[model samples]
Target: MNRRTLLTGLASLPVLPLFSGFTLAADSPLSAQPPTRLAHPPSYWRDKVSAEAWKVLFEEATERPGSSPLDQFYEPGNYLCAACYLPLFRSEDKYDSGTGWPSFTQPIEGALGTKLDFRLLWPRTEYHCARCGGHQGHVFNDGPAPLGKRWCNNGVALRFVPADQPLPPLRG
Candidate 1:
């Protein structure tokens, strides 16, 4: 099938809903409700993150594949938005897709928002942090069963907090 045909087929599939019984540990960064949206402008994050990270988070630039250490990282932790420190994904949902990026089957419920991107001359679902609106990455249909989602994320746009470490407070 052509790329467009494949994407169209994927788009027609039903998205799995978040589990009603799923719960994070009391100490985990995520809460049952969606994260509170931040009002800060993209410029507000200018000084908080490195230049490369700022590019990915605010400018919506994609990092080189296989360049992110997070792709190989399999530690138990939560991935937070590098721009605003909002928890975006849990370790349990992460997996290696051999795509050279940190891929997840799904994100923390309500942690991200999506929009259609056409920068590559085709439609793709681009997701960003729901709280800070920092661009994370594109979501594809080629993933493991149950969800069939591949949340291919930019490592520069995320900060991994090992389970042993307390999640940092949300930043502007």
Candidate 2:
């Protein structure tokens, strides 16, 4: 290699640790982490969900606002993670956040996990179903009283269970 190229790479070696250290921190046990659960192969999930649901749950793609029928759906029910059928939010917590997605004030205790999302160059609290590690949505500070937290969810990632219907038992 040229002398110039060799020297340039050597100069960058010091900076590499700064970025690699960030990755190590993420893997640290002290980090706020989701509980470990039974894992399935990607093919198993692909066979279970729709193309749209797959994009949102597995690929972390957001669905269009106001596009989900669940946005207008206010019937008494429980909202569940479509991937693992884990009950996440209750019908009583649902509200119109004007963001078009199904907004909730909170989730069932330990039903979800969170991480900081820097996708838009700003950090947002992104949450996922704890049972299956499926992407659900982000939680924001602006919302109704009592919690003032808006759990902005992608409707495609949820399955609504009517109040009269029984939800499937949570998976261990």
Candidate 3:
């Protein structure tokens, strides 16, 4: 289908509300109630992201490998969902796997998730937003140890937040 047709179809889909890190007992960053309502997507969001972006950010579509700006953005910053701004990964957690995507050794504690992705039609592990349920990427056991988890994220799926903002208060 054409890009606009694809985006329009996605925009009509409900935004599956997800919770933040602290809400879940295991710190699932994507735990809000699934979107049960459907409406036209917000104008700002529609304007901010392109139709292609909407597909990846909202529809969980993965881009062809080695084609995302985020895959090369190795700056020290926070990688957040471009759609919801929920913190997903930190620079320190990133690793170079030459997977043509930005690979993280870990996510922001609870900012990721995994499920069976049949896209490749091989039951690969699919990972995504713990909050908005946006598709980030996948995970693989073939990673450096200590965490031994590979969080492969799509470039357009994230917006990097430099460590400019003051840290939030500890949640004790």
Candidate 4:
């Protein structure tokens, strides 16, 4: 089954503490990344996306990429959190992995946390945001060269920032 279906099926069952393992160390490169920060919650996307998206990003749930338009976003743009517009993944870091959802080789340092996901029977690794703790997607060993990592993300949980604009400094 696809990752989303697996996630849904897993949700129907009780969660084990061990199911949430696979933490990247605080000093991990991803942990050193930056993102847009807000003192309060977002008003725009709070009312923009469907209820499911709200449940996923805001509530730290997962959204299936098949249901999210973001899966097809190959344009050069930044990926922001749908619920908060926090810049997460940039288009430059993205590449076509033919993995159904948006895929990236890198994220801004310190923006994401990696953990082990057992939802698929196999011990797969997953990553999410540090600030929002929203489910982004899984990391597979089978990816393009150099980095050799694929960060598969749920499109519904992300927003696109066109490459034409300069990204703001990540919040400290």
Candidate 5:
């Protein structure tokens, strides 16, 4: 099915309470500290990221599910915000949710900020990078045990840094 058709169908479905009252906790010691916030307008990121990434990060557009190679990518690395390079998630939290997009069980503490989204005619928790305020994705409760939270992310909105390599400096 097309993206519009799929999203339309999703909008018609009942909103679940999976995301209600959910909070993020640090999964490891490395994630204990949050990145400092960056004060840059969305336009500042337009030239830094690809057109498609710009749409997802700044325009709050969702990419088609299963379109991101990160969906199947399992590696020892970190996932940073594509727009500002803030480390958002660790590789250990990555998992297969069979939802096409990259899924995580948790995020680095203080790495994201969420607000209620009503674009679908229902309340959904939309998360963004805490540093640059770039849209990342939504968080849901349907996930593995312990936390039972799924951090569904747009692959285009993220840049993976393999564990063997040094992370690039954060961009504006």
Candidate 6:
């Protein structure tokens, strides 16, 4: 009808595709992304994890930068969720991001899930262990070549198993 109305409608068309797979709930800012369910109960995890691991994984607290020795730890091994023992990152993918945290170029296939984080008033892709839904870290674009994805992780949340050792069986 009106020129202004027509222009507004056209501009909005591009945004519709961005929301294609996500639905806004009636009462929350949360997208269609649902909370990842874990096989073990909260009590089970609480009993299994250290207080620091519990803070980072379940409470979503970030460890102090350079606090984890895992950042300098380069042994061939798998990085697993401290709470559930799920293998999340490979030693090969891990690198010296110099960000004071353990960094990986990518996660093991099918081992991670991501959601938006708005803590700093900016949106960031926060990823978690797909199996136990434990918060591992945020993935950023600043990383070495190839994938260029910096999966910055909290050392408190990860348990590294050296190549010489066998990974513990996955917890249900």
Give the distance in Å from residue 169's predicted Cα in candidate 1 to where it truly belongs. Answer: 1.1
In terms of lDDT, which candidate is strongest?
5
Q: Model 6: what TM-score?
A: 0.78
Query: Model 3 compared with the native: what TM-score?
Result: 0.68
Question: Which digits, one per residue and each the tens of the lDDT, describe model 2 over residues 1-172?
Answer: 6878867755553331221112112211223443455476445688788889988887889999999999989999899999889888899989999999999887776577666666874456677777677888888889898767888999999999999998887643
Error of model 5, residue 51, in angstroms: 0.2
In candidate 6, how many Å is residue 140 off? 0.2
Task: Give the range of the ten consecutive residues with the poorest summed lDDT in model 5.
Answer: 19-28
Candidate 5 residue-wise lDDT at 116: 64
In terms of lDDT, model 5 sits at: 0.83
For model 6, state the Cα shift of residue 31 in Å. Answer: 22
Candidate 1: 10-residue stretch with minimal lDDT: 20-29
- Off-target runs (Cα >4 Å) in candidate 6 are 1-41
lDDT by residue (tens digit), candidate 4, 67-123: 656666677878876654567787777887776777888776766666666675956
Per residue, candidate 5 scores C-alpha lDDT tens digits across 1-172 of 6879878966785543322222233332224334666778889888899999999998999999989999999999999999888889999999999999999988887888766677976567788887888899998879898888899999999999999999999886
RMSD of model 4 against the true structure: 7.4
For every candidate, C-alpha RMSD to the true structure in Å: 6.5, 8.6, 10.1, 7.4, 7.0, 8.3
The Cα local distance difference test for each model comes to: 0.82, 0.76, 0.65, 0.65, 0.83, 0.76
Model 2 misses residue 59 by how many Å?
0.7
Flag clash pairs in model 3: 16-35, 18-32, 19-31, 19-32, 29-130, 30-130, 30-131
List TM-scores for all candidates, in order.
Answer: 0.81, 0.77, 0.68, 0.66, 0.81, 0.78
Q: Across residues 1-172, which tens digit of lDDT does each residue of candidate 1 receive?
A: 6988968976884453333212222222334666666778889999999999999998999999999999999999999999888888999999999999999988887687766676875667777887888899988889998878888999999999999999998886
Worst 10 residues of 6 by lDDT: 20-29
lDDT of 3 by residue, 7-122 (tens): 78656643433333112223233343432222334343556567776788667788889997777677777888776666778888887888899898777765665565557534
> What local lDDT does model 5 show for residue 72?
100
lDDT string, candidate 6, 38-89, tens digits: 6664567887889899888877889999999999998898999898787888
Clashing pairs in 5: none
